[model samples]
Target chain A: MLRSESEAELAFRREVRGWFERELPAELRDLTFRPLPDMVMPWYRKLSRQGWIAPHWPRAFGGMDASPVEQVILMEEAARIGAPEIPTQGLNQIGPILQRFGSDAQKEFHLPRILNGDAIWCQGYSEPGAGSDLASLRTAGSVEGDDVVVTGHKIWTTWGHHADWMYALVRTNKDVPKREGISFILIDMKSSGVLRRPIRTLADEFEFCEVFLDKVRVPRANIVGELNRGWTVATALLSQERLILGSPGNALRAYERLRRLARALGTRLSDSDKLMIAKARIELETLIASFLDAAEGFRDGRPVDSSYLKILSTETTQFILDAAQTVSGAYAGVKFPMDVDGTTIDFSELFLQSRRLSIYGGSNEIQRDLIARNVLAMPRGRA
Target chain B: MSEIAGDQMLISDNVRRLFDASRALPRARAAAACWPDTDRTVLREFIEMGWLSLLLPEDDGGMGASAIDFVALIESLGDLLLPEPVGPMLATVSLLAACQSPAADRLLKAALGDERIVLAATEADRSLQGDTNHIVFDAHWADVVVFATGETEQFSLRAVAKIDVDGLDALVRNIDGGSLCSVRLDGSMGEELASGARARDIFMRCRNMQRLAAAASLLGLVRKSLQDAIDYVKLRRQFGVAVGSFQALQHRAATLHVACQSARALLYEAARTVGTANEAVACAAAKVKAADTAMAVVKESVQFHGAIGFSDEADVALFFRRAVALTAAYGTAEACHRTCFAG
Candidate 1:
């Protein structure tokens, strides 16, 4: 029943575009901040209060329950406005998972906090041993009466330092298959025996943390879905993560930065440079079309595959970042003050940050292998 | 011209159906293997369908369409790896269109239907310049011979075998194993349509037009390659999922798609701009962009296809070879880059 958009969609696009141009804050115009989670929290609250934080959530859960097309429109508007990157573990991953699979009481408690921006969440799925091969995670949790005692280390927990809660996959039945033995459990990060250590990355950013749980206790009611079926929950969350990961905000910001740097330097763009810009423009256009196609697929109740979007959006971000570095030249490495907010940043930091585009939310290499074997239906390489 | 005119979809459902039918024909492949001269039956079919005369003037028994039309038709052909004389035939018609001689008129008329004529532009020992040489060939089988040179000048008709040159076979071999011969022109057998500097002008324009058409054809080939890859990725599953579901391959396909689209947009722009006298630089830029993008897409399409794409029997490799050869044929990307950017 879901067909390509009627004229209504075009009108929606225009309205969204108009609103973005008018309401997007000046401080969010460029990638001038090391966009930390704390710096973005206030804006998150603003969007939450406006019921724009979780566009696809059911209306009953303080969300717009937007159609797939509307969800895309929201993301496009957010990118166009250079909206600050809100910490999304709560809004993007946890809240939706809870609404779909969690007990009513669990959703009653967590969904409101997420909608109010009163609680922040971080994923506790990837352990030191289980990155990529997530089913191999050794995190263990035992049900003890009204509580579950969990003990595991979750690595690469983005913004773990600021999160209020963590949803994790822990082994509940070790004798079962590696995937079936897992249980999804939510833990209060502030609970006793929960420890967090920041992991500094090459970009000199500590956006991720190593979270160690030594017998941390979570309420039994916090377990999502059936026991030892955590893999499905984890898989669902990962699908959401991949979709969010494929968003085009970073590339849009990079383009804005490129234009700003070009203007600041007063450098006359060569025809080739103009051609590059033209190509970038066309890339953006194509990406939008592809995204729309994907959204239509999602809205039609078909399984939404994020492979194409993730690959394209991430590479485009990297390309734009690379172009920005080229445009910035010698000053690319030098940090500059944000014109609106007085924060210092540099193209170098941006370039370093862009490196993660292909790594997190499943490495691009893994994505490529998926595409080759799954999409192309080529024979698998001999191990 | 309306800006929206450029956005008109080049690949329509009808064209796609035509390609599907053409690709299914066993005779098309056999005809392609024959090279320069395609099967007379196939040629007649194409001519009757108006594809062969797509760019000729309507009054001259042809379509009188623009370069964009020519590009759309040629790209469909490239997708099928149809080894028709579309390129040389189109180039010959273009050359005749640029000339005013009685011979040019006669050749143009013949080229619109069953008649075939090959252009001899690449000279031996000329170090890769695409200009037509003074050397002639035997006119015994030729209904007309176009001798073009430079921009804004007329083309003279020289009888085949009237010009003196060595290594014509090598030049012909370079152009997809087509037959070509070299000879000395005594200036006695052919009538001059334009002499001196004017002749040079006409010749350059003709060469540029040929190069532009070749680039367009390559663009078509690249686009088809991408579509082939896309179709393969969509249903091909691995590890319990479609391979296209993997982010890595998706990224590669996406990047290739962007490159192909960029080439297409530029090609359309260039074709539209070709009518304007001052758009020479723009056309050159388009040529460089389209040729480079086309070659890149075709090569990667083969690579992405893995073992199946590399086999000689696979239709993709044919497109790959055509793209590689065409990229170097007209003017190299480097030459176009320099020309467009030159002050």
Candidate 2:
């Protein structure tokens, strides 16, 4: 666990572990495997069926209303076993956004679908021209009757090909400033003129895509918050997004892999090698404290300081991955795990995949800027 | 913020008042005048205000105090870049207060009375068998230096000889830049407070307290430097607009604040649980993070403050120097990381 658990938390952990042992098929819990939709969704739906999908959601909206501790425990246990990562676009962001800003009709339509795993969502925020400067998005959505005709390209859309729909920022007014012209519109991926070209990442997985929208008409009711004010609505979940993206679970998984591999290798290592591993472990443990604080901060509506967590998680994971690669020695470039006796370990992907940790979730540089300006209230430089 | 005791707040306010009254501008103007040395008047005021007795326990006839009671006071002392060996002095006092020795009692009481000084000393390198510590802090100021000898086996209060400071950091130099002396000790002399494991235990507590205060102080220096940079970036224009208006600089400054806050949270958390497993990890983490932050913020602040920042006249440079010295004093990031990992 990332934090110390109360008796109840400990009991909950056991329950989760037991349920996972029974319900989470051993085949699905493979640490070496990445869970794609078919292999992943059933488990997600199981959690959803139990009303445990949205831990932070209110009971009124399909959530069990699990406390922050419970939510964190769920993440820790799931990540602990390398249970497939659920499609979090709906679970973490859109569901919460819709819950907060969605019209009653919108919430009634989408929130249930999201909880039930009947609908999958991808973010349409980052485009080739507008990654860190997301508000400068040029994707235009023009009003035509009761439909908004959106035409633009969105890149870095994680799971865009797998998603059934997307909630995106499109410029609804060109004459206004870059940010003010934007509107948050939900578009069906199967709509006319919608196209998805999958992007293969460094880890050799097609987990992301470029979502192409050409005159795709979305219903007017799908506009979240208000038109031209999508910036506010979209950014409403920035803290939540940061907290999720900055979690220590991923690092913990990586660290566990490193330790496991070290033990299996049976290689006699020098003191420094052991020290580096120790350093990463210490950092991972220290980061969990901050992570727990951030989680509670988000849940309790306290000022969450998650930018540091983002930096810490990524850097520490990379540190561990670096050690793993070193321990892998001559086999660092191998695509598949080289077998010793029976232990299979593919640190190549771990090393490659860890690279994007800092690049995504708004590059570490951008997070630093956010920390410097928003949190510190330091003066901005010349625009 | 709520953790501040009412008395602590008053103590901090009083310390700030005293520091401001002894404004170091004319003094800092002297260039070479730095820490471990004090402004006589300010030192006298601290003496009169009973600030000297803060580390002594009431059982020893003082306020039964600890850094937790007056951590704010320590932090504010850091903010002003006070030119006294107050930090190590207080830490040394606390060390003696915890040690069970008749000499410790007399030494601590005299230290509190401002009669005889008991400055903390650096440990002899782990390999050395006999007594030899060439890098003791404020060794020249102490009537008797409290030192850990021979890899934590011996906690000794020894009479010391002051050797002049050799290498120095570039504003407010480390602990009154003057009066820092290397000392030689006859291993046979001084009172043995504790030996072996018990000695190491006290050493950890004292070392951690020193580290916690040093990191907190560096954070204060960073906060002040960041503010100074903020002020400069606003007033000092580059091209047609104020440089402070640039998002690039703002973000960097914001990141420093994050580091400061993170370090602070860890510092206080570690402080609260001094003898726990959490304290060891927290102390090392806080030290590493805070030290790195202080360095980054200070160096970048020079650039943010521009041409003037490079000159000796810029008070921010003083902060930069103090940061450089402080970062290495209690422990460097590398050392702290080692402690964190190897603990």
Candidate 3:
């Protein structure tokens, strides 16, 4: 919006802004906590019906085919309205992967359901022993007759308990290297031997869980790509997912909360508080610019080190929430949402929830290691 | 990429080659202990190449480039640690050209030729928000200083020749080995360029442009320091291994590298908003982010170099000095935050 956007873009922004303001329900406007699926799905389906869901997808795949700027506009508007966070494993990750690598039959079955919110998908990549080092995942898939029997444990599966399906990486070739032996498969969450147990987060929410798959049998045709090539298939669209993760939308929301908290307290911010807030604001602006930089690089076929973007974006969001915690003063330790005038402000909920930003997707430590090795070409230490 | 971006890259490449061949750092070091003076050979080459007139109107013997292009040029200069006061000089002339006054025209001509007419500020022009603090940058090299005075919406531009100024302090050596001077201009022998709202509007525009240029330069400084540190860590061994191979140093370097890139992206994006309505906030944000990033990079870069980085002989030390001055130039990070949040 600051860069002298085109007339059409401005008009488009105005349109999106108006639609969000008018259509978003009052109950959903600015929740301090993550709304459960039952409370948020209607809104999600509304967006799907409005043809705004999966803005990054192609129109041929039941998506809006949004341009990058249009996609940014959509995100900005959603953040403007404080839209509820929806399950996005289907939209951000698997939808694109399936578009690229799924069989025609799989596309015909899953794409429409994903768009219409009939299906909720959770990624099944990280196992008990393979969080950051995902290549070492030991989820076994032994083909027996027409079925591939899957068995293993997957941790940190977001929305796994409520998901209708799980896209997974399973070891199909035991003798090969860890990464090379894997295969990508989709499984029904309701299938026998598949069990989900929600793990409580530090934020005190059941946002993610661990799933135990014990000899779950799935049709061999459920495989997305070639056997022993799940590593390639899973990583094919990671840069795009990282790009979405690296957007400044979350940081903007966090900064808005910080500003609101400062205003609600009705006290003069000390010099140090002001300085921290300013630093956060400045970092948010830089994150916005870097998102554009990487997106532009992506469009130009230039090498966009999405790892750097992910680190900057996620860490900046964390930094802002940290600032908010500082500004919260005596309210910093408050456990529940406090009514500051007409608004309910949770001083610690966001501060606690944001801790996951640096830990999930890929830990910031892993991201830093990747950047050091790939971008800087630093030597691998002889272990 | 568009043709303009292609042209920018070409311009950046040429500028890099020029600085690379000119032994810029050595010359800067040689002039550090001397009175405020830049290499005339390098300055003359720069002027002859029309860099000083980059922001002037095409009708005024210049290319009429946008602030984005100006940022491109300044960033390259900063990366090589060029000793000349080219950035300030360019900003000074750009302001003059925008004024469209006879006095401004005369000063612009002198600046584009050989004289160094750097931008200055007095206490009266609060619009710049405590940028100068009564201390003028590159004052030792200035043949004249152009300042804006009067109230916020009623500013007036004035030019004072360095020789006629009274109560001007002797050139103080800066951390970057540049020259700064405390001046008390009592309005003696000063020529007014314009008055009232016209001057105020032009002055604000010039300030935004200058902020963008400084931010771009600070980002350049950060990139150089970060790259140098990265290179050093790979070559320097510790515990019978390259220091860069250590997770601690690698993570630290990676973090700094991200900061450098993020600030740079902000700088370039902010440069594009120069003439837009959002220019003020965008420029302020860019300046604050770049300044903070530069400080972080320079500090960590010194650590990466170990004790050798603290020595005067190390170019990283010079970069630290330059970052310190430049970060304070347009506005300190605190002052800029006040301006941004207040707006």
Candidate 4:
């Protein structure tokens, strides 16, 4: 029976901790408690340059190929040291999916650019009509000999304006099942017909964009997996995306901010608050164990199940955020008049950001349905 | 960053297999018995497997395993509903280990086989504080009797008559309210092993270990009950639909599963912290969460089974009763909160 971490693993953890303490930017640490201007990408590029972009990615793809346990340690240390949240649509979502299902030439072209931080990716997944019912997408991608003619409207495209490339699921066969006829296609956002319009959110920030694809031409080689079978590839990508969405850093960071705010507000730590804190602590611990179980399952060559992670992570994040808002009370709605360095804290932004968490990367309702149908093997509800 | 040594996994695997094999034993019937006793053969098997010696130092002819190892063992034991004083015995061993008394080594060796020792920590008043009215069970079966005095500063060991609580039932009815009483002794008894804050620390450490072990056991019970309910609902049909096919029941089962997983993690984490100074607070939290979760899950298991679950003959009811009884053991939820607030 394995007892504790081996001496070698402990040493490895120490080294990683040391490097994080010495090398992680101070601004990243400050941003953990207060949001920084969205120009933190340069620091992200630094980490990517250091070959720490995807700690679990295979070495052949310019990754460290760290063990699952090692990756956990890295994540824990990174969270502890308040590493900047790398805008990771490419590293977390597209990179992994492409690695798994992309063609040889596609990998050869994009993997290096992704490693060098030369190419940024955004997801063109949800649409006006197909937010939750993503498979019912009306986005069209018709074969045009050497190029695929794509004409569609994509909404809630996160970081769309900054992205160099866009990955989308488009309807390729109109007569087939909604899920079966979709194709996962990659498109250059710089294409002449691609238009991006930013959308303002409750946070009073334009963090997402709506992209209109007017006869955008995507090469045939840009298709991930096969035509009309993109649902499987998309589903797999969504599974990994769900895991990324469920990471604990955001919740932990929010929790720390909540504690600081509570202290600042001079609120006595009530028994209810203490119990809530304890519950949050225990919830995090449980999530860590379940995360380890999923990681170990993957490492041991078993198919990783994301249902448990999805349910717990999403719900727990919302629960923590709700608790924070309750604890912060009136101050939670204080709006920052300007981009002050540290004087004015905007709790309202956190409140608004939290609302998007349960909605994005597949809504919590859809996650619950997926958990019921896939993990629990529950029969579908009657129409 | 730490790689786990393979020994822990090996021990866990062995214990898991042992637990799985023992689950085939007639649990519903045995658990229904007023004083369901563990088979002597199984006890011997556990001893031979070095499970009982998991916490004892290797110099004392034991494995010198950490507290987490014992937790795994306790979890396995609880999963099978194994009726043994494993918690009490491990408590005694932990106390002895902490004290480092010369007698601890000799006594631990004797405790490896037929020797049975139960800690007499409970009092009639149900206060967590130690009492002088220590009740040693079956002295003939025990080579030593470790007792703590009310002063919280002294522990006196004596050769005394073990009270015969055989007809009184092996499984105490009110675990929360029960008292352990042997014939009273006057003056400073036989031998003084350790005293003062040192002794009190050792005693409290033992109590915390027992609490954590019991919590882990309850976690196993919760797991078993939830799994049983799930399996039952999947097979048993109602209104031309499998009971599990109903969203209402499935939701209930999933909720219970979440609670069980939460409680399980708390128990394991608490167990990992046992014997340290933080053990009291951690153990209190673990016991409260695990006991409450176990009780609710087992009760739901019974309710979910319908009339068949209500009968004493049914295994669901058996688990329900055990969960109820165990919840009050070690300490009540309120008492745990008090302990947590004590610091």
Candidate 5:
């Protein structure tokens, strides 16, 4: 609804749009779901080469130093053209963190590799006990000469099996409160005793993995922040993480899928079915409006009300996905994409994958609690 | 969302000052007793302020204000919970301004002069009450009552009878309470302004205006409800501490705040796109979000206040009542969802 982006932002959108049209591989224009590394990484690096890899990063760090508007334009244009999102451990997660907390050497060594897609990074924050209550993560790191021996399991690591490096929070001291006694560190995924086991999701997607560290040694220099304050980095990272999570991308994608599914269903879809599809579109627009507002807040350095965005964005995406299933009715259970009438659409895989949106990036339920406590100032109910 | 224009800001400031001077909550409580119906003085003050003429073209001896500016004014009225029927009056004048008629033009000009109050259709269903007339919002004080016959696709207007009617607290008087009355639209009671396609255009214009105003009103109530809750939580203490300091309530309140703000943005967006058939879907979406968010905020506002919120004494209850009534005003959520999803 907010029209007319700044001339430069509009120009940036045009540039990104042209690049996607001319350079994106036809087979991979939308390598959605769990794309194998090869189908997407090379093209992503091509974007990296065009200086479109990480719009949020500083120009000196091999990025466009794009403003928030420009960044939104990039994502929006990319989504519009059916281009898949680039993996963002290096770009979104560790890149900014490293800039803020990494040593010059660490930044120099890692930032360029990330920019060129020479190294794809994966986060290692959650363990069996630490998904939502991340403070209690027991991914241990004990001191060993010139290194920290890490041992524990980290779950839901996106592209963990394909990652070149892992940035993680490891428990370094057990006696202190959970927030303390944790350190943010980077480790080579190729290190001895490292294991990544891909987990198949409801979508049959192998995009996530369970990574095990059997006393794998990460150099002491890899620690980003203080030895026992990884939570600070975690806290600092929330804004950016929420920014990405709260975006309208997932919702837009689901809406697009629903559109295609509805078309495929053709005469098969009842008026009620079509109505549901339209509802999804309306829901998507609301998410888009909500997202742009949040992004503007981020750009202004305003105290962001992100939990609402998180809850709204993720839940709306789920709603769209649910609608996709309804439109695809009966066909929703089919295994592969098929031409329903003239339109080819698949529902099960993407529908199943979208469920993870709410579950991850902090569950919407937990986000509501955070909103109640941190934003609304409600009394904390004791269990 | 771009900023509200400067003149609009000045107008809103004037309204804020008016509410500050009027002691809005007390005014709101007093207004609620009469419900959906309005005092001529309240309408006169609004007309005197040029609000009634705000959206009419300058050629019509009015402000030629943008829809968004109109939104700003309507929202202010909503925030004050003033039980005046601004929407129906605004819609009648704006619609009249668009039509080609010497007599209607005179009536429109007279309305801008605050001499006449016009009440247009505010309900969705076309069925006439008692085989003659149905309750029209603001009909109690209307100098003119206009309605669209869905079956014939025609427009008709009748002089106000000023009869005794009761508001159900469901469709009208969200801010100031009054009796919403049913008027006799049958028996050749009034004049036909337009028919066929022309009538449809007029209907669409008035429908969008009514819905947009309802949404804007809800936006105002949403902000007031959330603000009141925030203030209450900050002051109300438990366990020897400010309850607002607690994380749980903070998040809940934040959710409402976010919802309200987003709905506000949607309201403005809807305003910008209101009149075209191409943007009808967009307009419906905005009203739907506003209605849903406004209801959520008021309901939560009541909860956040605990026992007192459920009582008639708390002004938040009035705000809650207004939110509920406004949700179904113009078009109910079901109607809006149909507009959104149903082809």
Candidate 6:
């Protein structure tokens, strides 16, 4: 709302808003957790067919090439109608990486598949031993003439069990420095030795899976960039990743829950509870404003380090969920969803699930360090 | 850019230049003891710049600048920590113009001409002796006051000279060193301007504008404090490294920086919708967020500077005090939230 949008932007927003309200299925609306691929792919393909699936992708590919404001408007309208969360590993990470660093053959094969939901993708960056210190990965991939034999245990591969492929970071050479020896490659989940086991979360759902690759053979041409250049290839989009993660979508959903909780409680709400709800209101509103500002910065090629936005978005979402949990009263600790005045309140599920927001995507602490070292130019200290 | 946008930009640039040339912050610091009476020259410059009537319509003999342009000027005045009460003066006069009476017009014209200082007495202020003695903000510099009487939508505006008010107490300095006083006003006292719905609309608009202006000022204070602290931490050394290099402080600073950024965005957004259907909700959100963010950032900024930040000599200390005062100015964050939901 801060922007004096052109008539074109306004019209775009209205069109998008109306479409989501009309076309989104009632079952998919306002889901507290991500639905499994089997239930959500049809909706994903619907968005793809509408040319709105890859708003950030270039028009040269099968994408809408929407402007930054248009992209934000798309996200807002989607969240407004409570559109179910869709898998974005291909749309956000692998597809963009391929466009930037992939060969024409690689692009030609995978780009359209991603746009049409024909290939479900998952990121395989975090091996069991390589998380925040991701460069220290020991997952080996050795060249065998025309192929690369890969063996690695990738943990926290979101939707990996259902994904058709994984874009992985493997150690192509152990002789060079940790960051220098890594390679970004794609592996077929259907390969002989590739196995995925779903990991049950605290919320008792299989939102993530552990993917194991035992001598899995993939073509050497599947590598996204020059071997041992994976670190830079992946990092070229670090700021962009932060921008996508820092979006107000999740926070808005949590706020919708908070409003519902507040409305259900009504005059029964205590002053202290009301105050907490008010704080959440302020935080959510600010999160939205902050996202818009950061998005504009991203569009203008302003080198905006969105580490702070990431922290704000996740923490604000968690804060709103906290308020929701607080007002739940006797329903606060219920493991399952309960009906509260006709609204299904999944207080515990949403609240517990949000803990991953801060921990995933380079943990908030790592984000802080990035801001300190990169943005503030603070000197590195031994501690 | 459109002509109006270009003009607004020019107006903002001129205001920034005027504040730079006046050296208003140093002057305010030097005359700290004078409270509301200090920095008359800068205040006169603001009036001469035609900002006091910026929000009034051209039909009322004003420049009729939009609230968006007006907010830009107030944000600058805030960032510079000018002690002139220009924001309060402008907000109060703009409300006075809504009365559309001979008495209101006389007061408005006189104030706009830089002839006198006028301030609004809001309902949010504390009343002593069961509503007889009303506490008014910026009363030390005021020659006249425009206050509302009656209840709800039936309210009417009344104007009174400070000399005409009974039981006028000594000026009480606020946390930021602004002047306030308790004055007794019987129901029938000052010259009545407008009654019923018209007066209610005036009072309502005046309150909303005050909240917004205060929020903008808070944002300015937060920005200055956070930036000064960031600069200070880069220079201040401890344990053989700049203090900012440490993760504990760095994380806190980064969080506050984001808070400041978001608060600024909300303020500008809310300013854009000043007269729209979403005005109440947007304005309340902006005010509350700005006030909360200002307190968080300014307080942490003081800590980031070590012992020096706690002393009066440090500039951040001033921002800290101003943040405290402004957060409670139009309405407390809690009050704004209540009003937002009450509707």
lDDT of each: 0.64, 0.72, 0.80, 0.67, 0.74, 0.80
TM-score to native of every candidate shown: 0.65, 0.83, 0.95, 0.80, 0.84, 0.91
CAPRI band for model 3: medium
The better candidate by TM-score, 5 or 6, is 6
Question: Please, what are the lDDT tens digits per residue for candidate 4 over residues A211-246?
Answer: 999999998888999987889999999888876665
Worst-scoring 10-residue span by lDDT in model 5 chain B: B161-170
| Model 1 lDDT, residue A104, Cα | 89
For model 1, residues B253-300, the per-residue Cα lDDT tens digits are 655654555455555555554555534554555566667777777777
lDDT (Cα) of model 6: 0.80
Interface RMSD of each: 9.8, 3.7, 1.9, 4.9, 3.9, 3.1
Comparing 1 and 4 on lDDT, the stronger one? 4
Which digits, one per residue and each the tens of the lDDT, describe model 2 over residues B34-64?
Answer: 3445445676677678777676667756676
TM-score leaderboard ranking = 3, 6, 5, 2, 4, 1
Question: How well does model 1 score by local distance difference test?
Answer: 0.64
Q: After superposition, how far is residue A130 of candidate 6 from its true place, in Å?
A: 1.7
When only the first chain is scored, the TM-scores of the models are 0.87, 0.94, 0.96, 0.89, 0.93, 0.94
lDDT of 4 at B3: 21
Off by over 4 Å in 1: A1-31, A34-38, A56-81, A270-272, A301-305, A337-345, B1-35, B38-40, B43-78, B84-317, B325-343
Runs of candidate 3 exceeding 4 Å displacement: B1-22, B115-118, B122-133, B186-189
Top candidate when judged by TM-score against the true structure: 3
Residues B1-343 of candidate 5 have per-residue lDDT tens digits of 5455687778777756754636767876766554433446556766788867778778867788887788777776677766566766787788877766766677777777887777776544443345544656645567666666644444443233233223322243334464454444552545666566776677677777888888888887778778888889888988888777766776677667667766776677677665544356666787888888888888888898999999889988888877776676677666777777653
DockQ score of the complex predicted as candidate 4: 0.21
Q: What DockQ results do all the predictions give, each relative to the true complex?
A: 0.08, 0.28, 0.66, 0.21, 0.36, 0.44
